[model samples]
Target: MTSRNWLTTLAAAALFPMLAHAASEQQLPSEEGQLTVSTVADGLRNPWALAFLPGEQGMLVTERPGNLRVVNAEGKVGPPISGVPKVWAEGQGGLLDVVLSPDFKRDRTVYLSYAEEGEDGKAGTTVGRGQLSQDLARLENFNVIFRQAPKLSEGNHFGSRLVFDREGFLFIALGENNQRPTAQDLDKLQGKIVRILPDGQVPKDNPFFGKTDVRPEIWSFGHRNQQGAALNPWTGKLWTHEHGPRGGDEINIPEPGKNYGWPVATHGINYSMLPIPEAKGKHVDGMVDPHHVWEKSPGISGMAFYDNPRFKAWDHSLFIGALVPQELIRLQLDGDRIVHEERLLGELKARIRDVRVGPDGYVYVLTDAKDGALFKIGLSGG
Candidate 1:
């Protein structure tokens, strides 16, 4: 940790003595079974995402305030690892996601998404990668690979989540920078999902690869603010979810060259309870509808698919973190369609920010708060 962070931690420890200790284990009831919620670690400041390391290396976690740290198996949060690029650190603008390379064991490479400032004080979502040092104290030779275009000055809606497909292509989800009209702009990177090579090169087979006046990196467009993304192991397709204004938090399977209607046609009204001006109706002729939607927005965030069989009851279910409702949503899938929904973790009442299926087949979640926590969910008495 830097001197500043060290001092901050000390001050926080003084005010909250529990900051140095993990929360007691809690048993909660779920539809499938009694669930065990264990605090792997706490005192994380607005942690946004986490990626488990190979072997016994613990896990890498990113705090939204632009700090990255490792939490060991003993649930000890280490000092911040060095070499993270400077971030905007404003509202919803900071270090957001961390993911390991597909060939992480060989390359030891790690990827990150964050809010980066551009010219004229504007900011946009950016992606970068670096090799992890052997000591795990810093990143080596980190460099940015991709950046969202026309960096607007808006502070919200960075819409960044990184997912590497089975074929090795990287998919980056972007927000419209709270600029509603940009969602319909084909020439802009805002409100679009872009596919690129691991090293940040545009893929030749991308939908708009050779198109004139369109971003070659764009795989799909017309998104609002996608915060959760994952590759479906069963179909090898990318799945994502985004927040809606007043209602209509939605799940979508983003495909190449597809248009998902955002401001143009929505299942939601504006935050002021008025109809969206650009919307023609809830359904539009040229845009694809969401695969699943929630009438009452849950302020959805991270997403994961539980394919592991350790918890047979949760096997093959989709897990989504909810910020507004402070729950983890388990959506039962029947092939390509959602057949049922179960909400979990309401007893914790913390903003569930990120969800991941651990290597041990247990479910892991991160809470979004001033003093956030990392929780692991498993069968209580299995």
Candidate 2:
């Protein structure tokens, strides 16, 4: 089917609300019943992230090609919003995630992360904030809030995910920028989870704030390419997933000022199949180990915490999108640890790039493809 035609049909369906029921208690699907999957929108060019507005009116979606689209409840993909920065549009380096400010109702502020073009053919990830236009059609007052120091020449590893904490502070996930050594540098912001105020000021309480050797914005370091990060609703803890080269995708709970031991102590080897030194012990004294890990890579993307009542049975779980496995994984959490995992929609045959629990309490997924699709998955008892 044509991309436009598919979007038209899905938009029409979105006009009418669909009811969802709780799935059966068993981890596996019921023998006689099936979950319903419906396309809510299409024609997105590698949709990277999805965030719902205050009301159920619409949502803001990020296109990896440097476009921010407003998707209405009717599933219509509006025209690309302006004020997006010029990005390094190659090899996963383009416009990335978009997030609404915690005070969206009071101030219509929005945050965006992308691979900003740098001098002399260099490029690096940058985080920006701006106010959504009064009509919500475009962005205005756009300003760079934070930028990685010493831009790298490589086009890959821009872990540009944004998540706000309970204290209204923003945390940015930065990748190693294809330079493994940078991940261990305390002075550079690359390959680190940085904590900063909305205006790009470093937090005073940051672990290394006053330290002369470390950048004040660095919260934690030694990460490879962390793509997925979410705050647990129950515990308010930050959970992140970093992609390893050959295998060893990790799920970690980041602590202030702690080193994560990426290249120095990794379960995974290099892409060229070289061995990496393992952590001195199964669990290091100070470094955190992954609560759970994919010994085989699944190409993890965005993650979200499931707290809405629509899936009451699945409340307090972590939902992660997988690109290679092409599925949504629901991880049952028990006080900072993942107890169980359930794979959903592996049969869809699409690279699931982002998974979000919508304001309406349904699970929304963005597919990664030339003609990408937005899908809504709900429980429909057959």
Candidate 3:
């Protein structure tokens, strides 16, 4: 038997507690019979987001210390490719997410989100695009597409995630810069999800378009620190989840021009454990309620919809990575309501930073650590 088959058998025999760590394999239930968790690569340093390249192009991974590299299917990690934009690299900052264009096979264009330095050392989230060099060694013709306005100091909440709509518009998620009131401010780009054409042009259909003294890219505002976002395969709508203060993390499907209640109304208290002075309970007159809310913070980060047929039972489920609680969460959804929740990978005991479903129908995850790793999960036991 191959090594993987051996481990799968050993895990079935309850022998994985020793042989399957770091390069670990764990077993679980599946409607198909059994699930297998396999480690694809390890020894990464603070790995963040993952983007799979076109056929035979391997996968690109961003390490938070500002390095981007490609890892092949055989688990060989290449040297860091050059031309990544400079990043703040402090607190929650660094090279954040890497996503390819919808037409990436033809364009070779990739989008990146990171914390950028502003005047006087203050920092904020920024987004940019670059074409991968033919040799796959550099990001050529790179340019900033969007930068959060009125850059603020301190490095806690950069709330950066990127997604594309059916119209091929880019949706950028940002944080409040830990400045609570900015989320309610129409003038600041902080604490808002903005939509822009891939080339950095403002869409005329934007809600704030033609409005005086407001950033035209704002799609929805009043978010706290959204770190995870994905386009729903079933509905074609954008879904987002964010971190809350002491608790109250939320999952929302923000409508165009809608206001999602954040600091102004929350189930969470201040980090100091005191009631937020501005909070008005969970409901407000005009603001929209979260489609789903987590009364106890999951410290949720990256998320993706699992519609691929490799795991037929997982179709329509949402998989999310958690930080503080450290687990992979699977939510079974019935429309917008969460009907069931399953927590997996608890045996690994690592903080999951990002999760994605590979084109090959495997679920991939990136662990958050000084010595991080990348994982690929599959199903077994036919």
Candidate 4:
């Protein structure tokens, strides 16, 4: 953490597998080994998400300004693919996460989430899906699948992270739209995680499907801004991390119809240094508590699990990307609990947006900036 150590780490980065952008390689020490953070592609505009396409084609990256494009294996970026919906790109609202269908190889379908503009210029989160054309230049038959209910007039906190479980159910993360109280409102879709079938229909077995006076799509409630979500491949349960108020960021294993107690059971206070009026000091009688809470936030963003043995030391570690601190974090876990935390990529100075572990056994991260980039994280000398 000293200047001399930081400089030494940078000097060591020159030894990574020198791809085209090798000159700017950055390095940092990891508990497992030394990590090489090298740009795989560049010239993107505020990329928010990434998904590897099937058949060795490449990766699909979604930019915040309403563009989706491909970054090929050789680090070549293709033109923006056509047919993406026009986004209400303002104040943290824009095109967001992209993911392939569980049956992508057969269906050639991809899903997209973005901030959709409404009447009076209000915006809210919306999800859609389309089949990628054979030539990769356009999307065909794209249709809106889900939209956040009661769209708010503000733009911040439009959480749009996406994840699909093995059962082919799609889960979408929605933020509370900066309306703090909305997070705990059972009747509202804001600040909730919702699940639907591949075609965007409510599954009959959904926990709240037959309930009254609530959005049937909601799987769980009381989240703030959940920008990171993934399924624990071992347990088949959904795991997510969310941005809390000034502090109190949390990690929760979202279960059916559970109340996460945002605003009511928070360990954080308002950014203005005022105690939240509804907070009951981090616990409420009927709500679930977070498995882990960061009293001093790192501005958590994207996350992914490293289960591959390619890097033995990184096994079972969850890699989290941070924005304000401009770093990547490694959270080592034992069973259901986080056992250790290691911070990396702090010196890179870019808002770490999304992180993904690729089939090739390398971890990929996207940065948030005008000339954002995709980076590959790997160990040196491996």
- What do the candidate models score in CA lDDT, each in turn? 0.89, 0.81, 0.86, 0.86
Q: What is the Å distance of residue 86 in model 2 from its true position? A: 1.6
Between prediction 1 and prediction 4, which has the larger lDDT?
Answer: 1
Model 1, residue 298: C-alpha shift (Å): 0.3
Query: What lDDT tens digits, residue by residue, belong to model 1 across residues 1-382?
Result: 4566456445533543322333577899998779888898999999999998876678899999999999876788999999999999999999999999999999999999999998788799999999999889999999999999989846999999999999999999999999989988878899999999999999999989989899999999989999999999999999999998899889999989999999887899999999988888778998999999888999999999987645668767999999998999999988878998999999999999999987666788999999999998877644
Worst 10 residues of 1 by lDDT: 12-21
Per-residue lDDT of candidate 4, residues 249-323 (tens digit): 999999898999998899899999999888988899999999899998888998899865456677789998999
TM-score of 3: 0.92
Q: Estimate each model's TM-score.
A: 0.93, 0.90, 0.92, 0.93
lDDT of 2 by residue, 1-382 (tens): 4566456435533542432222221222522235567777889998899888765447899999889998876677899998877777888798898899999888899999998877777788999988888687888889998999878837889898899999998999989888887888998877899999989998899999899978999999989898998888888888888898788888888999888877676667767786764434334556666767788999999898887655446667888998988888888878776788888888777998889877555678899998998887766531
Candidate 4 backbone clash number: 0
Q: Per-residue lDDT tens digits of candidate 3, residues 191-271?
A: 899999998899999999989988899999999998999999988999999898899999989888899987888889998
Best by lDDT: 1
Any idea what lDDT model 1 has?
Answer: 0.89
RMSD of each: 8.3, 6.8, 5.9, 6.3
Ranking by TM-score: 1, 4, 3, 2
Least lDDT summed over 10 consecutive residues: which range in candidate 3? 13-22
Report the Cα lDDT for residue 292, model 3.
87
